[model samples]
Target chain A: MDLFINLAHGFSVALSPMNLLFCLIGALVGTLIGVLPGVGPVATIAMLLPITFGLPPVGALIMLAGIYYGAQYGGSTTSILVNIPGEASSVVTTLDGHQMARQGRAGPALAIAAIGSFIAGCVSTVLVAAVGAPLTKLALLFGPAEYFSLMVLGLVFAVVLAKGSVIKAVAMIMLGLLLSMVGSDIETGQSRMAFDVPELSDGIGFVVVAMGVFGFAEIIRNLENQSEETRSIVTSKVTGLMPTWPDLKASAGAITRGTIIGSILGILPGGGAVIAAFAAYTFEKKVSKDPSRFGRGAIEGVAAPESANNAAAQTSFIPLLTLGIPPNAVMALMVGAMTIHGIVPGPQVMTKQPDLFWGMIASMWLGNLMLVVINLPLVGVWVKLLQVPYRMMFPAILIFCNIGNYSINNAPFDVGMTAVFALVGYWLLKLDFEPAPMLLGFVLGPLMEENLRRAMLIARGDPMTFLYRPISATLLAIAVFLLVLAVLPMIRSKRDVVFVEGET
Target chain B: MSDGIQAPSGRSGGFRIRNQQDFYGGLVLVAVAAFALWASRDLPGMRGFAFGPGTAPRIFASILGALGLIVAVGGLVTDGPPVERVAVRGTALGAVLIAIFILVSNYATPITAGLGLRQYETVLAAIVVLLVTIAIARGADRGPLYVVAGTLVFAGTIRPLGLVLASFISIVVCAAATVEVRWRETILWAAGLTIFCALLFVYALNLPFNFWPRF
Candidate 1:
């Protein structure tokens, strides 16, 4: 098949010694950060971003992609060994994985998670090869109005995903959008609400906002309650790592079901790994005959969610590579990465930079392979890190974060902004308001506004163009259906699952 | 859930301080809105036409301002009982250390070693940090003193002394400071890393570096 040959060519690009080394390094670092409870792919990627400035696009992207999926692998390590989920996507893992740890079956929990992730990752990469081209062609159909409507729907969906009172979520999202306006006014080239600060000329860096609010705020919340504890995960104590034949049989169905679900969901705009993992866990729960075992160390819980999350992660790349749409925060960063290389991701990407495109796709499968080989064996080593006190860890992390952020532009203003945002995030956490929706709003707000205004200007101020356009109309309908069906009921329940581990 | 571990009778001062974040955020949102509202006051024309450049930001800011109020109110007036409060000692100390970092980063950049590149000011900064380890130890502890001595021996060797000597000194000093590095264990790990980094970064990739000492 022509596709096979193209893929082979992609392999040639990715298999280089230099690219291989970067991939290995990325896998190692991503896993290390992932195994650590507090650090995440986003922070790690952001720190590594400046280092990527000089490398050729292929090598840089290969390494960055490794971090994203590798993180999914590393995050599971924490969830299985301790009750902590390093990042949000692994929350479901903690339910079952931690139980396994308590039962002294942490080894099986970890092994199954890693293997499931690998299988899911491989299958999703295949799906990407098959579907990536078509979606790219489909993207060519979008005009400014369509993009505007799509972004609006995306932001709304994000708000809907926040498990809280819809009103408060909406409130936080709106506030987030406002926070985004503090720096430069794009259209008029005038400062918006900067209050004459020189830093206002450039908009607030997304990295600074995310790191300060999410990273530092998390540390503060952790520190305020020092009596909280994590059961030490002694790797030596874990037994039955090689899943029993029965255990393997049980998990195969979940991994298969999860991969299919993840691939499909991942293709949609802004519907990435976290959502897929959650959706798979929900599905696995519904299908299992013994539903009561959903939380207390269910291998299916770890397997299905981890598999789906990895599958989603790989397939999520399909959109960004094929259509230039960001499914989540990390993909948004990838967009920045691509832009730095003067390559815009869209229909033209497949045609113009076929090597970069195919190479990246081919490399993901290879990267996933590298991750398991790199991580599974080192489970023993990472478990040892849990012994380090958070007091010692915190200072190092803070200093590193400070250095990374300040060196970004050598601006004290950004540092101040980071501090302010951290406080804001802490407040949001304290108030039981989820800030996840706000982050979505920050990304989509300007894009949505731009598209909407452009559509208005182009159609000579006709509002009906939104409904009249086929693609825009279709997406809007889905948004409405989601709002009416799933989101409304979730909101109506008024019970929110705790995303933060310890909060008032 | 334990009987003896009474849930906080009410929000603790720490919780209260954190709780005020919603209001502070809301207030800033209000200010943002006021500024936007004032800026857009001059849009003299009717809105039946295409939007002016500033219209969306204005509307967006206003929406945010409105949303902030709801968040602030919900935060201030929640009827449900708050969750149990327990101290997280590790997290607290981390915060304190980080705050110190923020202070140092903001006010001082006392450049300490190796490439006088302002970025390397972290060296001097890290040296100051050893004081915390010392302070925490109380009085007459050898750990703090050994750390300084080891650091001096290590920092002494850098460019003037060559990589092996400098690194050996620094590691021995820092390792000796609080955590005793079994000389054998320290040497093995440190040597492994140096060889790995040199082979992978220096030899294989051939990426240029300031391997020579920065005068």
Candidate 2:
């Protein structure tokens, strides 16, 4: 009953003229950038952070959320049409989505993806609303020790779930923690690593690092394979705009199962959406009677992963909204946005600012609805936009990103800093180090340190407090278990098999 | 997996270093950790169980250093993929040259200031290095160099020259990053984008951006 009333209030807020407009704009711009290969949601959100500075907190958040869904939707479109997955989550989509396109069933593949995503979005939005309040309540049980332990678990989850060498991932996390310690200490106000630069006192801006690592580094990498300029775009006109009844019936079960998988995984602190899509597609294949049909124009392939990813994308917000912990880099950027708006994320947000909380939740549903309506009819437009060569597109992105960086603090030094990090990101790519874990570590570092210090002080310097507390101990135990599981050679091979997408 | 590591050190008559990526990557991490430790050396540490600013940093840095060492050792004992080759020679060289130039300029300030070129020294040095590096760099490798140069141009010019000129120059400069650039098309596109960005950011969004050069 309370959920109903709260949702009603949320609908009222989301339906407001200004909020709706922002949602629409966010969806459009998100799709626009997400359609472009090499730019992920992290960079998109970081680049657009400056634009949200002036917006009211609710509107700003709504817009950012809209951008996320739009970006994912656009990624599917790119996969189907160009066989180029816009980002990692969409990589599996290209397996069968593009196959469907090649077989001249591009329209049905796209329609099913959109429909599946919409259904998943609807289900997950409700799940988020339902789960958010209880999770916030659960958060009330957490002490400083518990919070610290939880963060440790979250980082471990990131490492275990991330596709890379476990040792390298752990190293990256440590490096991120080290980098996060650059600014002044919270308790003492004593600068740990300003290096005499005034700007360093604020610590490195998250936006600058994000734009540098994901944005500019991606450009550098994309430039590497420009010699293979052949992009096989499906020039055939997309005729059937809707999936047939049989296509719908075939994907119904897959969609439900995908939504379930995505919702569960999305709550975990890791690369939820990427793994969710992969897991969904793999599960679909495993359960199918004719598993061999998966990579060869199977509509279930397009439906399941798309649904899972969208569901995962939305439900990943659960951790961020409930516990004040961002599950991934994109959510970390959301934390930055919230901080900038003078709204601290956590359990308190629900009780203190119910309107903001519920309104953002409601806006997500509306945003999903908008994506379906805006994207389906606009598929041809997106396909046309895809024909724009990368050569011309990159410079525009570069200029805009530079301008965006400058706008953050009106500081040119930030621009220079971004260039440096871009170099670092490019170098990391060469070294086979995944930047995602490092980013998650950077986001959680200060919080973890603060909690650890508080817990220690409360326990009068006894390290045993973490072990003594049941919740904290459990979290730490799980983290260790996950770490061990990831390190085991047998599990590692299985993990690799799950991630292997058949590239034609 | 057993062939390389299980064999005696001199079995193949060589001390083979496997997994160069992890080896170098781990070494770099160790260096970074060391740098962090050095940077935080002055901050106070534990005072009777209470952390004094530096405790957390020193702790994490030490952990990172240990982890880095483990990775480096793993690289030695384990056989894995070799480091992927990337066209970073030009980019790396440019960075090295820039560092050298900055160090020399800082140390030899008296020499540079005597010529009344102190204010222009860094900027001039950067431009020259960028040009030389771009010229010498392979066609594919120039992307990052040109992109970096473009960003620096925007950073350097945005204040003095204002948004229009800064954005225009940066866009044009960045277009040269790829060999596929068509000059006329790029110039027109840059100009159009400059106008659009200036209007959107300055007028529509009303961010406090100057339209023309302050001077």
Candidate 3:
């Protein structure tokens, strides 16, 4: 009953005229970027982050949330139409989604994808509203030791889940931690890595790092691959915007199962929409009577991963909203945005700012509805956008990036820092190091350091105190288990085989 | 499907042992870590029971150094592709542009004072134009040139020319970098994008940027 009243209040806030308009704009821009290859949600969000600064906290969050899930919807459009996954989570969709397109069933494939995503988005938003309060309550119970242990577990998960050499990932995380140690120490006034620059006293801005690593690096990479094959739309005409009865029946079960699986995985640290989509696809293939049909226009293939990724994208907000921990790079940027708005994310956000919390929850449902209405009719417009050459597009992207970075602090130094990071990011890419883990580490570093210091102070420098606390001990144990599982040759080899199979 | 938009997998070329990327990457990390460790030596640490600023960084630096060693060692035994040659012209041009921005932003007054230029802003603008022209002449890819120029122009001119004019000029310059440059279309795009940005960022959102040059 109380939940109902709270949700009603949330609806009142979200349904306000201004908030709704921002939601529409966010969704439209998100879809635009998502349909364009190379320009991803991370860069797009980072670029648009400054725009949100002037918005009220609730409106800012609602719009950003709209963009996050809207990108998931738009990603499938490209996967089915152009045989390109606009987002990483949509990679698996390209296999069967493109196959269905090739068979001239692009309409049904796209319709099912949109419907599946809509269902998944609606379900997950409800799940977030229901489970988010309890999660926040639970997070409030954590002590400094527990918090430190949880962060350690998060870092381990980040390393284990990254699809490359574990050692390189660990190194990247350490480097991020080292980088985060720049500026003045919170407790002591001494600067760690500032090297005497006045700007170093405030630490490197998250926007700088994000734009540099993801935004600029991506632009350079796209330029390097200028000879990429032009994507041809699979069909000029998208007929029958609705799926057939049989097609609907086949996907109904997959959608339900995908929503469930994705919801669970999305709550886990480092378990993002990308992994959820992959896991759901693998689960569907394993359960299917005709697994051979997976890569050859399987409707279940189009439905399941699409649903799972959307569900995961929505639920990935759970960790960030409740526990103040970002599950991935996009969420990390959200944390940056929230911080810029003078709102520190965590358990307190739920208690002190119920309106903000519940309003954001309500807006997710509204945003999902907006996406379906916007996408279904606007498919042709998106297809037209697909024809825009990459060369023409790159400059616009670069300009936005420049203005975005500059607008953050009105500092050209940040722009320069972005340029430097772009080069560094490109180098890291060439070296097989994933930047996601480094980002996770950077975002969590200061908090982890603070928690570790507090925990040590409480323990009076006794390292064994971490083992004495049940929650901290359990979390640490899980981290160790995951590390061992990742390193063990037999398990590692089998995992690689599964990933390779999925890749093909 | 092609992993085109995803993060790089570092498996672009055929396998080689000699110039392993991890080897070079590890060396760089190790050098950075060592430098960090050495740099923090002067900072005080471990005041009473609580850890000081230096302790946490030292711990991180040491771990990074160890991980770097392991990665470097693994590179020796692991079979992987050689490090690909970086696009030197693009990279150098990018560096030069950044250096110029930083120098102009930080030391513009000092530089103009030293050179005794009566109109430092004009001199700075000329220098930017000259650098970009040289870069383009030296076969720096036009794509990067546009990006560099746009960023530099926005950074340098935002104060003098304001948000609207700065963005318009930057966008126009950037649009010319494309393979097929239509001046009319480029001008239209620049005008459209500039107005859109001005309205969205400056008017509706009301971000604290100068709409026109203060001077």
Candidate 4:
């Protein structure tokens, strides 16, 4: 009954004319940027952060949620139409989505993807509402030791699930921690490693690092592969906008299973939409009677992953809202946004700011609905946008990023730092190091340090307090077990197979 | 440890690097760790139970150093793909062009005055601009050098030159990054983009931005 009342209040806030307008604007801009060749959601959201600066906290957060869904839908569109996944979550979609395009069933494939994503969104939004309260209750049980241990588990999950060498990933995490240690200390107010730069005293802006690493680096990389083959688009006409009954029937079970898998994985500390999509597609293949049909225009292939990714994207918010821990890089960006608005995310968010909390959850449903409604008829428009040459597009992106970074705090130094990080990003790419884990580590660094310090103080400097606490001990044990599982030769080989199969 | 011992006896001679990517990547990490250590050396460390600012950094840096060593050693023992080749000519050209732009923008006015050639300042600037464009047009496969140069220009000029000129210059420069650029088309596009951004940011969004140069 209380949930109903709260949800009703949430609807009232979300349905306000101004908030609705913001939501629409965010979705439109997010899709516009997301459909471009090389700009992923991380870069897209980072580039668009300035637009939300003046809005009320509720509207700002609601619009950000809208942008997230829109960017995801845009990524799926690119995957189906261009054989180029806009981001990693959509990579699996390219296999069957692009194949379906070649077979001239692009309309049905797209319609089914939207349908599956909507259903999954509907299911997971309810799941988020239902599970949110209990999780907040659980979060209340956590002490400083548990918080530290949980973050450690989250980092381990990121390293384990992330592709590439584990040791290198761990090293990247340490580097990120060191980088985060720059600027003024919280307790002592003593500056650490700033070298007396005024900008460094505030520490590095999240937007600066994200725009530099993801946005600029991606443009540089796309330029490197500027050969004709990379940007080829399927120019076939998309005729039938509706999926047939048979197509719908084939995908129903896959959508359900995907939603279930996605919702569960999304709640995990480090598991996010990318892994959810991969797991769903893999699981669907294992369960299908005709697994051979997967890569060859199967409707279920488009349905399962799309549904799972959307579901996972929404559900990943659970950890962020309840535990004050961002599950992935995208969530890390949200934390940055939240901090900007003077709103701290955690259990207190639910109790102290019920309107903002519930409003964001309700707005997500509205955002997903808006994507389905606005995007279907606008498919032709998006296809036309994608037709714009990459040469033209990259410049506009570069300018937009420059304006966006500059607009944040109206600081030119941040813009210069973005250029520097772009070089760093390019270097990281050359070395084959993953930047995602490093981002996760950077976001968590200060929080983890604070918790560890508090925990130690409470235990009078005894490091064994982490082991003495049941919850903290359990979390650390899971992290260790995951590390061991990742390092085991048998499991490592299988993990490689999963990734390799997706590419082939 | 066993792999490290066996690496010397394997097909290649002693101490031959097997995976150059991790080897070099790990070495860089170690260097970064060392730098962090040096930077935080002044901050106080642990005082009894509580951390004193520098403890966490030092701890993380040490761990990074150790992890980097392990990775470097692993690269020595493990067989992995060699590092991919980086395109040198294009990137070098881009870096040089950016350096020239920075030098010209920062020092051109002062140097011309110092040489008592202040009357020829515009000529000098125009010549440098022509040289940059010609070099851009003539260079084979320039890649994305102009893109970086344009961003830095916007950062340096946005405040003093304001949004209009900054946007115009940035778009024009960025458009030249690609080899397929048609100059006339790019200029028209830049004009249009500048107007759109100016109106959207300044009027519609009500952001505080100067449309023209402050001077």
Candidate 5:
């Protein structure tokens, strides 16, 4: 079979001793950083960008890819144990995972997280093998307008799904768009907010803002709370290496459905892992025999989101590999890294580097296996990390904070900006202004501004063209429809929750 | 959205400078916008460079200032939820620690001179900051102040220390400063982590520069 032959070629490229070793190491670091509160995989991979400067591009990409997904697995660990979701995708996990922990069922919670992730990883890998080429072809239809519209839709969906006021969520998304535009104008090469600082010529780095806001701010907030009643969870003994037969059966079908659903969703521009996680949860809730079980500590709640997030993490690679468009921050950073290596991502990438493409894909399976093995044995270690007092652990996190901020360029100016932003982030956190949407604004703001300006210039400042251009107009139309409808879904959800609570 | 991070900003004074969150957010935005508007005098419209570099940032940052004002106004209009304020003691200590950060950050920039010496300056400053920070943390009634200050200072200095030294020291000192371990316990934890990172980053990973002396 062509699949077998191609996979064989892939394995040949992937199975080298050095490659295997790097895969394991990447998995280890990914998991470690995932356990650590502040730094996630995207920034870690970005921090290591310079290290890969001289290495072969294939090896570099393979390792970076490993770190990305491996962190996805590791992220769930903290969420399950400590109620701190290390990455955005894992936020849904905290709903039930932390609930299970408070009930002293932490062992089972962590086990399901690892097992669900592994199953989804395998299922997604198979999907990637079966449909990567075709999906890559499908992705060719998207242009800048499509990408922008898709982002708008995704943000609206996120706001729709977010557990907060709809007005605030919309405000957050708009805020995120605005914040993202704060740097230099990409098209016109105009400095948007650099203020003549050499370091800011590139704009505010997300890593600094994310770490400062989510990571540091979280710690500060936690410190202020007088609830000293953190109980130590004992999972030193794997009370259940295997999920009870009922547990396995309940999640098995959900995992399969989530993988399938996530695979298709991921191929769409802007539908990355976090979106996949939320979408899968929504799907599971809709199809559940008893929808009331969700949000109140349903095992399926954990299983579906975990599966979808990982599957989406893999499949989102379609656009990046095929058309060279990066739909998210991590992928954007990957684009920057690849551009540095002079290997343009597009159709020719697969052809010119069969070994690279196939090998990276093959390596993911092996990497997943390594993650399960390495992460499972280390679950007890991570659970114990929860026992480490905040007073003691806070300093070490700061050190990582410094290192991560510094590694962005080893420039003091970046460090200063991070502090400035951290203070700003802390203030926003206090004011009920969501920082995540601000980040979204920060990420997409510049792009949107650039594209808007370009369209204007092309039309000689004829603003009407934005509404008249077929592709752009359609996207804008869809964005408007979704934006307006975002709150409707929430009212439905609230009514459903109230009804469920009354019945229960 | 408050998620109980702050005891909802108290309704007292209706918008005191004491609310550090909106203060810095507003102050920074207003200051930066003022600077941008001042600097824009140098740029021409539709110059050879498709659009001059300052054109977009000035406009964007100005909007940021306006947004900040809106956010601040919102804060001023609302009463924070009822909860015990984070001990003013903790907030005051935080301010003191931040003052230390500003001193080091504003001064350390010129001191580094952008030479290779920047690494040493960053590391040494981080060390001194870490020690003083930890001492303050342990000695003061305030909690986690040292860790926050140390982190802020290190984040402030990291760019000067190349990735290797900065990351290594930042992790080492911050971990040392924050973790609630016995001195003997911390020394081992700190030394072991430092050595392990040194080997992994320097020897095995082969990143340039040997930060700690190898005897």
Candidate 6:
């Protein structure tokens, strides 16, 4: 009863004229960025974060949330039209969606993708509202030991889920943790890694690091890929905007199963839209009567992953909103944005700011609806946008990144730091080390440190208390199990095969 | 399974010997971890019932050092592709541009003070001319040159030229980075973006910034 009343209040807030307008704008911009290759949501959000500084917390959060899910919808457009996955999560869509486009079923593939995503979005928004409260309650029971163990588990999962060498991923996590210690220590206020620079006293800004690594490094990588000059985009004959009844019948089961899989996986630490999409496509192949139909215009291939990614995108917020733990880099950026808005995300957020919490949940549903309406009609516009040369697009992105970094503290030093990190990021990419794990570590490092110190203090430096507590012990055990699973030769081989297939 | 550690074909180039990207990456991480550990050694640790600030960092640093060592060892034993060559020209040009921006932004006042210049604007103008000439002489790509010019100009002139004109100049300069720049399109984009940013950032959001230069 209370949930319904709260949801009603949420609808009132989200439906208000001002909030609705922001939601529409966020969704629109999210779609635009999502359609543009190489400009992922992380860079777009970081670029636009400064604009939200003046918005009321509710309006600001609603807009950011809209952008996230909106990107999921927009990502499919490029995958189907140009055979290019605009976002990582949309990579699986290119396998079948593009094939469908070549076969003149582009309109049906896109329409099904949007519909599946909408269904998943609606379901996952309900899941967020339903599960958010219970999870917050569970989180309130966590002690310092439990929280520290949770972070350890989270870091371990980050390594397990990362692509490429496990050793490199672990090293990146450690490096990120080390980098996070550069500012004044939280406990003693002693400057640790400042090197006598006053700016270092407060630590490197999260926006600077994100923009440098994801935004600037990405630009450099795009430039390095000189072979991408001749792109073949399929914009002609985009007929059949709606799926046939037979297509709908075939995908209904896949969408339902995908929603379930994605909703569950998304709540787990280090499980996000990309993993969920990959997992769903693999699951669809396993369950299909003819698996070979998958990369060759299979509608189930398009529907299942699309639904899974959208559901996962929404459910991935559960950890951040309830536990204040960011499961991925995108969520980590959300944490940064929330902190800037003076709202520390944790269990307390729901209890203290019920309107903000519920309004965001309700707005997710509204945003999904807006995306369906906005995307179907604006497909032509997005296709035209895809025609813009990367050369022209990159400069605008660079300018926004520069202005965005400068706006953070009205300081030139941050821009300098961004340039430095961009170089580091490009180097890391050259070495085949994924920067995503490092980002997760950077975001979680301070919280993990604070909890570790508190836990150690409470246990009188025993360290065994983590093992003694049931929840912490269980979490630690899971981390160990994941590590062991990752190392086993058989499982490692199998996982690599799966990842390689997905990559292709 | 035995060949799992090998670099996937086609990714390696001349820089790496024996496809040792992991080896080099591991070496860098180890160096960083060793430095962090050494630097934090002097900080206070455990005191009475509470853990000191250094305790957490030391713990993390030690773990990181151990991980780095393991990765380095793994990298050495694994058979993989040769390391790829770094984009030296692009990287160097980027570094130089950033260096100039930082140097000018941080030292413009001191440089002007030493030169006994009357106004900061005059010093800024002189620095811009010198940097732009150097950038062009070095055969820097239009992208980096434009970025350097835009950022430095925005930083130096934000206070004097105000938000609108400074941002306009920055955006236009940045738009000119591309090879296929059309003057009409660039100017229109510059004007539109300038007005949109001003309206959104300054007018609607009411950020604490000047609309026009005070001087």
User: Over the stretch B20-94, how does candidate 5's per-residue lDDT look in tens digits?
Assistant: 444444454556556656655454445432344454545555665665665444344334342224433444455
lDDT of 3 by residue, A1-504 (tens): 767888898899999999999889889888887778765677778777877777899999998988877677778899999987787888889999999988888889988898888899889988998888888889999999999898888888877776767777788889888888888998988887788998778899888888778876777666666665667676568777788999999999999988988888877766478788889999999999999999999999989999998898889889889988887788888998998898888889988999899999899888988998888899988888888777567667777777777877887667657767776776676676778778778888888899988998889988787999999999999999998888785323424623310110
Query: What order do you get sorting by TM-score, best first?
Result: 2, 4, 3, 6, 1, 5
List the global CA lDDT of all models: 0.65, 0.84, 0.79, 0.81, 0.60, 0.78
Supply DockQ values for each candidate: 0.15, 0.58, 0.36, 0.53, 0.22, 0.37
Which residue pairs overlap in candidate 6's backbone?
A: B16-B83, B19-B81
Q: How do all models score by TM-score?
A: 0.76, 0.95, 0.91, 0.93, 0.75, 0.90
State the lDDT of candidate 1 residue by residue for A230-250, as single tens digits: 555654656566778878999
Model 4, residue A130: distance off in Å is 0.7
Per lDDT, the best of the predicted structures is 2
lDDT, candidate 3, equals 0.79
- Summing lDDT over every window of 10 consecutive residues in candidate 5 chain A, give the lowest-scoring window: A495-504
Q: Which ranking of candidates, highest lDDT first? A: 2, 4, 3, 6, 1, 5
Candidate 4 yields a Cα-based lDDT of: 0.81
On residues A90-172, what C-alpha lDDT tens digit does candidate 2 reach at each position?
89899999999999999999999999999999999999999999999999999999999999998898888877678778988
True-vs-predicted CA distance for residue A488, candidate 6, Å: 2.4
Error of 5 at A165 (Å): 5.6
State in Å the error of residue B79, model 5. 6.8
lDDT of 4 by residue, A128-178 (tens): 888888899999999999999999998998787777677777888887788
For model 3, residues B1-215, the per-residue Cα lDDT tens digits are 11122333477664435437777778889998999899888878787768888988899999999889877766665556877655445656667766665666555676665776433553375357546644563322665555556666766677666788888887777665545567887788878888887887777777778888653
How large is the interface RMSD of each prediction? 10.3, 2.4, 4.8, 2.5, 6.1, 3.5
lDDT of 5 at A436: 53
**What lDDT score is found at residue B10 in candidate 1?**
65
- Which candidate leads in DockQ? 2
